[model samples]
Target: MKRTTIIALMMLFGISFSKAQTSPTAEDKIHSFVSIKNPPTFPGGMAAFYKFLGENIKYPEQAKKENIQGTVFVSFVIEKDGSVSNVKTVRGLGAGTDQEAERVLGLSPNWVAGTLDGKPVRVKYNIPIKFANKTAK
Candidate 1:
């Protein structure tokens, strides 16, 4: 009787441990962007997108003059249709840096949407923007 009770308790604990180790289902892990439908292609790839940012982003003169420098982390949802939406700054520095990061992300042309199980899926991407002061020789 003692051995049987010990075995039963061990089985119960094992079952509970197994349950805790189970991963969440795909549906449960889906992000909000997955529910919204979007377009199929972005105008350019990553290289071109970066080029756009370099060309368009204006480093704040005041910040640069003061030698303020930091990285801004921007988060956005890439829709299944290749369109980027819900642009926001996850990490930021003051001195007009975060706004510039948001502006650049918002202006980005679509991107190649990510896929899961051979179907387009919304994915979250984080972009880091850096600002540095340029010194005159």
Candidate 2:
């Protein structure tokens, strides 16, 4: 009786421990940017990040011709595995600029995942992309 009781308690304790220490999952809650200890980063930091945006984002011909310029705020989740997902434009200037911004952002390579309490976590990130024609005044 004593041995059976001890084994049952140990098994119960082990199961609870495993459940509590589980890592974040794809459907797991996303941590806000402000709460992250180490925020996610592009492969080469801000400069490289901007360079990538510049190289990928193309100004719409119509927008360029009409001189429609503004900043597009893109938001997404950087997953614990460094994959980009849920890309969206929070604020956009319409007229193809919105679609272009989303497209370029979706093309981005994986980033360094953010961390909280020293463990990798999914983080919500936002970036403002400026759309300015060379001739914009």
Candidate 3:
């Protein structure tokens, strides 16, 4: 009977230990740009990010034809592993800029992960994309 009780207690402790190991803390939480020690960055930095945008951003023909010119604001999460996800346009000009902006962000390469207290953490980031007809309109 004593041996059975000892085994049961051991199992309970083991289960609780496993649960403790999996429990999340502030370190696991997604942090805002201003809150983290190091904000996430494109691999080469903001200049590189803009260069990538200029190279990859495609102006929708509909937008060009309509002379739609404005900025789209996109928001996304940089995960702990530096992957971009949950991309969305927070504000946008019509004529497909919203969807285009989201698509461009989806094509983004992984970023340098943000860190808090010297450990990697997820971060929320935002960017604004400007569009112009640029065709003598």
Highest-lDDT candidate = 2
Tens digits of per-residue lDDT for model 2 on 23-112?
A: 655558798888766999899998998999999988998898788988999898998899889999999898789899889888989999
Which 10 successive residues of model 1 have the least lDDT summed?
A: 32-41
Q: Score residue 119 of candidate 1 by CA lDDT.
A: 73
Give lDDT tens digits, candidate 1, residues 14-94: 999998889765643435433435423345665677788889889877677667787888888777676777789999887
Candidate 2: segments with Cα more than 4 A from true spot: 1-27
Error of 2 at 116 (Å): 1.6
Tell me model 3's lDDT, rounded to 2 decimals.
Answer: 0.88
Candidate 3, pairs of clashing residues: none
Backbone clash count, each prediction separately? 2, 0, 0
Model 2 pairs in collision: none
Among all windows of 10 consecutive residues in model 2, the one with the lowest summed lDDT is 23-32
In order, candidate lDDTs are 0.74, 0.88, 0.88
Error of model 2, residue 63, in angstroms: 1.0
lDDT of 3 by residue, 29-92 (tens): 7678888769999989999988998888999988988889989998999999899998988998
Q: Give the winner by TM-score.
A: 3
